[model samples]
Target chain A: MINKESVIHTRNLSRSFGEILAVDRLSLAISRGEVFGLLGPNGAGKTTTVRLLAALLQPSSGEASIAGYQVGIDDQEIRRKIGLLPEAPGLYDGLTAEQNLAFYGAMYGVEEISQQIKRYLELLGLWNRRHEPVGTFSKGMRQKLAIARALLHEPEVLFLDEPTSSLDPQAARLVREFISDLKGKGRTIILCTHNLEEADRLCDRVAVLNGHLLALDSPIELRRRIFGRKVVFHLSATKTEFEPILLEFDFVNHVEQIENKIVVAVDDPDTHNPVLIRALVEAGAEIRFVGELRRRLEDVYLELMQASEGIINGTN
Target chain B: MERIKAIIIKEWREVFKNRFVFFTVSFLPLMITALPLVILFFTGRSEDFAGVTTADLPPQFSSLCSGLDGAECMLYFIVTQFILLFMMVPVIIPMTIASYSIVGEKTTRTLEPLLATPVSTLEILVGKGLAGVIPAVVATWVGYLLYAAGAHIIVSNPHVVNKLFDPLWMTAIFVVGPLLSLMGVSIAVMISSRVNDPRVAEQISGIFVLPVVGIFLGQTTGLILVNQEFILWMAGVLVVLDSILFYFAVQIFQRETILSRWK
Candidate 1:
């Protein structure tokens, strides 16, 4: 059990290797039970940030703490508090699935070590193949074992670096579901990923790490900020007779009839959606649902990139 | 201490897990030391080993084999084993310990997680050295036991070999053997930590063997031999050299520098 009071703090953390600045003066706070997504394009210092947090690399300047222990000063304490699943799964290739877990569990001093190994072996549905060496396991199985190793010690904070990078759609869904279940329990998670769709589904708030943080907000908040608010409705309707009724609503900025339902892109949908809903009711249309719909993360992210490029062009 | 025990167990288990490594650590020294003697026993007529070709051997070596019978000839073989294999094994000892300790972690990607653990670098070194050493020493004793058995059956005399089991070789085997291994392992570890490529570390660590091999040949060539006075002088030289190497190895093994370069 982690103390809810524990705060992941970085005062002015920085890391450099001679001429290369890997991470620079990153200061941020992550609280218990919040899933904070870290996003960046390739070579944008995301992995370096994860390594520093894991204390696998020492900071060149300033301090950061996990569970209130300073980066270099009390690094082991931070390590103990956080569960790290690195980008490439760090597992002993020749060892069996069980043996791989044992190695990590021993490192963490996890009590009842063998018992925990058994638990993960069963939990990940790898029990039957427990005796088989990990080298022979599929990529997805190996990744699940990596996640099991990370979670074996039941760490308070979890740092996941591209946890589902190599999985198939089914395997990816399973991992996303697991992450979602974990967030409900209030574990502080820092998910580092390039998969925009996956990040939108799993992250409570995401930091758009484009050279610097372009935006940080819940997925919905970010979409509305970048692409404006819109609503789409799919209705089981008296289709031809009810089609004309949606045009008279004063709150709707625009409406389009595609197939059976009306699509409305509204400026103030909070107040406008209700008026549309009532108009449908008065029009004798049996509306199944009415809700605000916005740009999927795919569109929002591309728009963000375009906006950032535009900003750079105008300034230059 | 618990962490030390865990790491040591981990190292031993890993060593045992690999058949090639386990066989090398558990049986190679014994084979290298005893297999030649076994061939000599099966094919050698008593006269071949015991004849003491006075024309070929120096007076000192000839005189030491006065009886030149089974046990007596075996005693001479034991002394030879000490001079050659004793030194050669230590050379590889450092390579195995260092490469396995550092490179194995890098291969497994356990290096980062291990460095993060509560265990300090020195403690990890102790675990590594012990893992390399205990097996090496056990293999040495196994070799000695095989020699004892072969000599008892093959030799005409039993007491002569027993008499040559003096305090010096015993001390060399028990005390100095592990010390030399520790020195080698420490140096190898420093190299391994600096170099990410295991093969490169192993190759670089192979440089440590040159001095030992040079001394072994110098002795065989009659340029040097460990008589009482000479042994005392060499002891003094070795102590000074080992101290310097020890200090240098520790100084070069900088954790921060290595981690930054791990690609």
Candidate 2:
């Protein structure tokens, strides 16, 4: 179902090159101001999906609309409403940083081009070097300039493909901070990346794709759906005797004992934990502490990718 | 229109900075214009054609130079020969620039970002086309004026100097020169779209100049005469060729093909 509040909507969107399907039967609705991530390994159609949504490439099948404008039909309008930072910085090395922004700003028919160029240049910390040719810039500087160019037009939607792929740690952090700042401005951003950590930190929801939609949800929710919630109770002694007691509770799905710790898989850890602790304490148990097992977004991403591979292998 | 202007301005900024492009646009026209003037200066001061008459001239040029002295006829023939060389200015200069326009953007990986903008494909092609044509046409006209001024100073015969302003040369420089530049740019744009290397595109597009060179050869060998009718016919053919080449260029420059298929 299409959400009326969605800024970007696609249904059964498929794009293929010759016999190889790059994106297959993918459907998604990205609401306004949401940072949606497209995550997958190489050859997973992440870039292709961004290109399709940006209206740089035509979809082989299905429909997409961005900012209420249909793709393929209103491509120029869609282009006007969106900004794309391609994988490569793709700057003109011969032109100065200010000239680069001025050219793109004019292409978008941006008013007060100089002011916009100054605003983004200062924001990206490249204002002092605006007169220098891009060829003289470092890799990090070029990436920052490219970002500024994308945002100079104040686009309603921004598509960033691997915005921090090649940067050093410090540069990457700066870019991440910039993206986070944009998030606060309530502009819808579609980030295509394989950086699970980046996605987990920046995305409200992410779609794991491998030429097809594998999974889509918030990082925490995907972890919960894949691994379920587990509460670990640290006991004062050997925990073998507490496993059966925890399993006796109907809310506890499964229980395992390992080295003075009772790991209980429960549906609702918040409410079930207190009741389980009470039962364990009443049954002559000494619980040292209680904590919920946390899974990283990396684990969730790996599990989803493994399961996708398994299904493909099983079908073959 | 603003988008097109932006592209044109962007292209000029980049093209002006390129050393090879600057050299070709500035020096080639000056050289073409000067070489003929040097030839006329030296030949006018020499004694080789001092005592010659209409009997000594080629049969094709004998009647054309009947009223002129030997040196005057010789100077007139030399100047007419260089007219086709002036046409070469427009063809070669634009090919130098237009050949690199699209393919250079591809090698630099800037085409994707440019295409992602709201600018239409036609606007881009037109902008790049004009960027290449304007300089070449302007240089050709300027070089012709320099040659005209230089010829009048070097040659004492008024009739021979007057031949430079003939309607044929006027039409060829003013009308045919711009068309040939457009034709060259269109072919370069088309070749640039399909080829991966700008040098390769330039080499292939350079083949278009051979026909003009062949005409020059034929004119010098008395096999073909470049008359007013010939200039008009060449302009007509260029108009048709430019139209066909531009249509194919737009068709081949599809956004999907460029983003996906360009290696």
Best by TM-score: 2
Instruction: Report the error of model 1 at residue B202, Å.
Output: 2.1
lDDT of 2 by residue, A74-97 (tens): 999999999999999999998999
C-alpha positional error of residue A111 in candidate 2 after TM-score superposition, expressed in Å: 0.8
True contacts kept of 2: 0.88
Q: Is the docking of candidate 2 incorrect, acceptable, medium or high quality?
A: high
In the range B1-263, model 1's lDDT, one tens digit per residue, is 65667677777766566665555565557666676567546644355555455455555555345556443454464444434456557557556755766777776676655665555666676677677766666656566656555655655354545633555455555555566676677777778877777678767877887877776677667675544344445456667766777677667766666655677
Candidate 1, CAPRI quality class derived from DockQ: acceptable
lDDT of 1 by residue, A1-316 (tens): 3334646777667777678776767777777788888877786678778778877777888788888777778876877888888877867666788877776777788999888988877877888898888879888898888888888888888889999998998888878887888888878899999998888988877877654456778888888887677777767855554446766666666677776667786778887777777877777666787666757877777777677778978952
Each candidate's fnat, in order?
0.32, 0.88
Tens-digit lDDT track of model 2 for B119-207: 99899999999899999999999999999888888876678878888777899999999999988888888888888887898899999
Off by over 4 Å in 2: A1-4, A235-240, A283-288, B46-48, B51-71
Q: Per-prediction TM-score, chain A only?
A: 0.82, 0.95
DockQ in order: 0.36, 0.84
Q: Give the 10-residue window scoring lowest on summed lDDT in candidate 1 chain B.
A: B74-83
Question: By lDDT, who's the top model here?
Answer: 2
